[model samples]
Target chain A: MFEATQLNRRNETTQKLFRLALGGMTGILILPVILILGTLIWKGAPVISFEFLFTGPTKGMTAGGIFPALLGTILLVLVALLASVPLGVAAAIYLSEYAPNNWFTRAINLAIINLAGVPSIVHALFGVGAFVIFFKFGTSILAASLTLAIMTLPVVIVATRESLQAVPEAFREACWNMGATRWQTIRRVVLPNAVTGILTGVILEVSRTAGETAPIMFTGAAFFLPLLPQSVFDQTMALSLHLFVVSTQVPNMPEQLPYGVALVLISLVLLMNSLSIALRMYLRGKKKW
Target chain B: MTAMAPIPGRSTERSLAIRTSKLNLWYGTFQALFDVDLDIRQGIITSMIGPSGCGKSTFLRSVNRINERLGYVRTTGTIDVMGQNIMDPEVELVQVRKQIGMVFQRPNPLPISIRDNVLFGHRIHNAGKRDARSEEDGIVENALQTVLLWDKVKDKLDKKATALSLEEQQKLCIARLLPVKPGVLLMDEPCSALDPKGTEAVEELIWELRGEYTILIVTHNMAQARRASEECIFMLMGKVVEHDDTGQMFVTPKHKETADYIEGRYG
Candidate 1:
């Protein structure tokens, strides 16, 4: 009975065929990533130098380093994180811990999903209308970062809520039974456990913020800036926008220059993603429950 | 059993730790408790035994106002803890919870160190006050010893509480509640997650805890009820069938349903 019959043999063949198909599909998914990174490094490695990374773009964006753009991206990502992380985490805590299960909270949840679904171009338009024009910030880093923060708020909130919910109800019950207030329970028990997850979400937001070119295009990012931004109110060049300008908008731009900018931008995002994954693994290892 | 820090407001005037009258509860439209009237004595173990969905656990949770955590749950009638109606709007939930501690079916230790778990409730109750490390250590050792867990876990106080075995975790859960000096303890099948040996250990700990704290435990294990409790309560279909001395109830049940349940006719 244990011996393979004709039917069993056929079934095994079909299973093997399906496995191959699925593995091929996964390989197909990874193909573009490998190709893009390989091409960027292969073409861009020659252009990379100490001066090429730290100096401002020269000769009308055809040459020189991307220091201004690099600094601007960092500033934008940091400011966006500052604005979004606190607001998102607090909103998540309220929804998860305090909000009564009612239509009002359901509506708020629905609004968040819809907000996340809104197009980046629409967010760019909104940034122009609200932060830049209406709020009188006027095409500055503050305006762009706010737009990015709003766009990524849903991500942070959802991640935080999920992590908070992942903490077993038993822990909260244990706290509440001890006469610990909800705030006390959250601060002592809930938030500490959820921090690494929250950090992962924040890192995801950082990577996304660094790559996005549309939202900051009209709101803050300039095609070329002679000086790096000194404050949130200043317009600045970003890596993503610089890559775009060099690749399509600027004339006589070296082939490797755009590739180099793209390589740097991709590297930054990947590094952030790696950091987040590492952090999550570290924290998860430390946590027992 | 060493001298515990005196919990303020532990009045010895009243013999009854918890008194409930005409207690009715509902999960949305489905009523789970029907006129549950009980007077659990102070410093004794009272075990409620019943088939599933019989409102025994509901009654236990109601004592601590924990059932209200479910948004759809609706309860009526009064539950008095230390002579105060906990359901009264003027009564703060924190105060109600402070007066009563609960252990769940599964051991739920905070994902924190053993030392931290032992000190969690104490710190919360004593907000903005810092206890000396030695003093805190004393409290930890005392609580753990009371639960019969100190010797097993004494040296690893800084280790994660969740890393302990299920039995130790349950004991830790119980130990954490002690420093707050709750007037009553409610347990909902606290050993249901444990193996046979673990169940016996926790049951013995509960037995040992009697006369020091009033503990109301809900159990499906008939033998556990008989062995651990001083008084016994039997309920079926959301109504109490009998409440009597543990030995007397098991030997000769007052009601047919109680007898039928005790004999394991159907649970």
Candidate 2:
């Protein structure tokens, strides 16, 4: 009865065939990433140097470095982090811990989902209308970073809420039964355990914010400005915009210049992602049931 | 200053730990507890025994008001702890909980150091009045000693409480409640998650805790109820069928349902 029949053999072969096809699809997904990284390193490594990283672009478009653009990207990501992390984490705590089971809370959750689904280009337009024009911030770092913050808020909120919920309900009950108020339980127990996950979400947001070109294009990112921004109110040349300018907008640009900028930008994102992964692993090892 | 304050100078043994009258509870439209009028005496181990969904656990949760945490739950009744109606709108939940502690079916130690778990209640209840580390240490040692866990854990008080064995974790759960000096402790099948050995160890600890605190525990294990508790309550279908001395109830139950339940005819 346990011996494989002709039908069983056929089923086994079909399963193997399906596994091969799925494996091939996954290989296809990974192929481009390897190719992209390989090409960038091969074509762009020579252009990366202390001088290339530290000096401004010269010779009618691209010959010097992407120092200002690199600095601008860092500033934008930092400012966005400052603006979004607190707001997103607080909103998540309210939604996950305090919000009653009612239609108003459901409506707010629905609105958050819809906001996350709105496209980057739409966010750019909204940012321009709200911060740049209506709020009179003008085309500045403040406007662009605010736009990025708004774009990534849902990521932080969702990750934070998920992590907060992941903390066993028993822990909250233990606290509550010990005469703890909800705020006391959340402050003492919930937030401490959820912080690592929240940081991972914020880091993921940082990587995305660094690579986004559209939302910051009309609001803050400049095409070819070589001067470093002194304040949030100053127009800055971000790496994403610089890569675009060197690749398409500028005349007589060097062949390796755009590749070099793209390489650095991707590396920064990869670095943030690796940091998040390392942090998550380290903290998870320390965390117990 | 609060109206929920206890009446002074009542004899401890005769005074009620918990008294309920016409307690009706519903989860949305489904009623889970119906007219549960019970007098759980103070400073004694009273075990409630029943089948699943028989409202033994519900009655225990209702005493501490923990059932209201489920947003759908609605209760129309009075649960008086220490001669004060805890269901009164004027009574603060924090104060109610401070006077009444609860332990769950599964052992739940906070993912914190053993010392911190022991001190968690004392810290919250005494917020803004920081105690010296030395005094806190004494409190921890005393509480752990009471639960018979100090010898095994005294050397590693700073280690995570979750790292302990199941028996130790349940003991720690009991120990954590001691620092706050709650007048009543409600446990819902606290040994149900343990192995036979662990169950015996926890039962001994529960037995050791009687007379110092009013102990009301729910159990599925009839043998445990018979051996560990002084008084026993039997409930079926959300209503009490019997409440008597453990010896009398086990040997000569007043109700047919209680006898059938104890004799293992049906849960």
Candidate 3:
């Protein structure tokens, strides 16, 4: 080992380098988010207009609106939430409340964490093959929703599970002692206490579903779709897909409207995020859990 | 059941509210309880005092089967509450739990208004429907009054339960337990998490409710055992070392271990 005096210079330099490296890493990780958000506001804010928002896709370099896309995003997210909320939350309840500390429960939990890390594009492909080709539903809103549900299932499931876990064991005991049946306990005490957390998870998943592009593109994406969906089977437009189209395809002409859509999309994401935060806050406020 | 209130002046009946015979529990392969037996009489306060991890809580959970939810924990032997074997497959745990309520070591108030928190058990059990407003009001008042929390919390009943001080929250939990009209009350170191004043408040409440139901309390605080209980049971290494009148146990314990513990020889 070197003497204290001999190591002083190198140690000092190493500490400075470590600090610099940390700072550098933080910037690198956060740069894209800041840039994308900044660019969206800067480029998209001006394009916000009532008229542009009401119209449909235009050919070549003409002014168009995000009404169809917005409608589609809402529908797709709603359907996905509808499909996944019950199933994912139920799975979470099983994992946390019902499942034992056995290998089976552990395996299921591990699979869910892994599912969350799976690529969105892979989910898209699964949706296309399963819902569209094998089920013969055709490339439509139904396919897109199924794909998005699978994509967001992990988020909602984990959130629900975490919320359920957050509940004190005493609460469950209290419920049981109150003569509540098992399902009754889950429905009354456990679920009600866990609701805010579940809702938060749902809101977050909604935002995630809204932002996805490649998945939607894979299942039911149409670059210039103009129609509103009437059913799950009807092909529809969505906000995220439209934003991708506007950002990459029509960056030159009527630039303001796309930016407007970008701003709207950003607002939508922020709104969902804020909603998730609010639900979680409400969940936390009830205190017992 | 006419659970409008505890109905004061009703003659306290003599009965065994809970009985346990040769109870044993295992955490994985580790034995937590070894052939333990206990009896909780109606309308009396029974205190369980023991060192930490001496199966006091393990014994408490067996009362309501909350231990069943914990992983790899197994139990053998019979636990009878109100002459019903809770361990019987046909016996409904949730139903059994309702008959015997519990207050935890830590105060746990649901994230809701004080009113809703008090009404929690009532609403869940549907003891009285929402349309039964008069019964609801009476039940709420009775439960709150039993815990001596009525006057302080009445005005702010609509406020969130978390808004209350820690002592108030503990009282609210007691109030919640009241609506169940339970035959027996199990308190697992209920005052352990409270300050001296809060502990005194809970101790007073326990005495106040004694005539209405049986009470079993687990405590690590020796002075509390001396001050608050009539009959006290002491356990060591998951075995009941001694059981006798609280004053006698403290003054002249039956076992040397109990005497040594009273003198702080070994905890």
Q: Clashing residue pairs, candidate 1?
A: A52-A65
DockQ of 3: 0.44
In order, the interface RMSDs are 0.8, 0.6, 3.0
lDDT of 2 by residue, B235-266 (tens): 99888888999999999999989989999999
Give the winner by TM-score. 2
> Which parts of model 2 are misplaced by more than 4 Å?
A1-12, B2-13
TM-score for each model: 0.95, 0.96, 0.84
Candidates sorted by lDDT, descending order?
2, 1, 3
lDDT of 3 by residue, A1-289 (tens): 6557757988999999999999999999999999988888887777777766777766652575677887788788888888999999989988888777889888988999999999988898888899989999898888888889999999989999998988777666656666666676687668887888888888889888888998888787677754577778888887887777776776566656667877877787788789778867875765542
lDDT at B63 for candidate 1? 89
Q: Quote model 1's iRMS.
A: 0.8
Instruction: Give me the runs in candidate 1 sitting further than 4 Å from their true place.
Output: A1-3, B1-14
lDDT string, candidate 1, A204-270, tens digits? 7888899999999999999988987888999998999988899999888788899999888988888
Query: How many backbone clashes does every candidate have?
Result: 1, 0, 6
Docking class of 3: acceptable
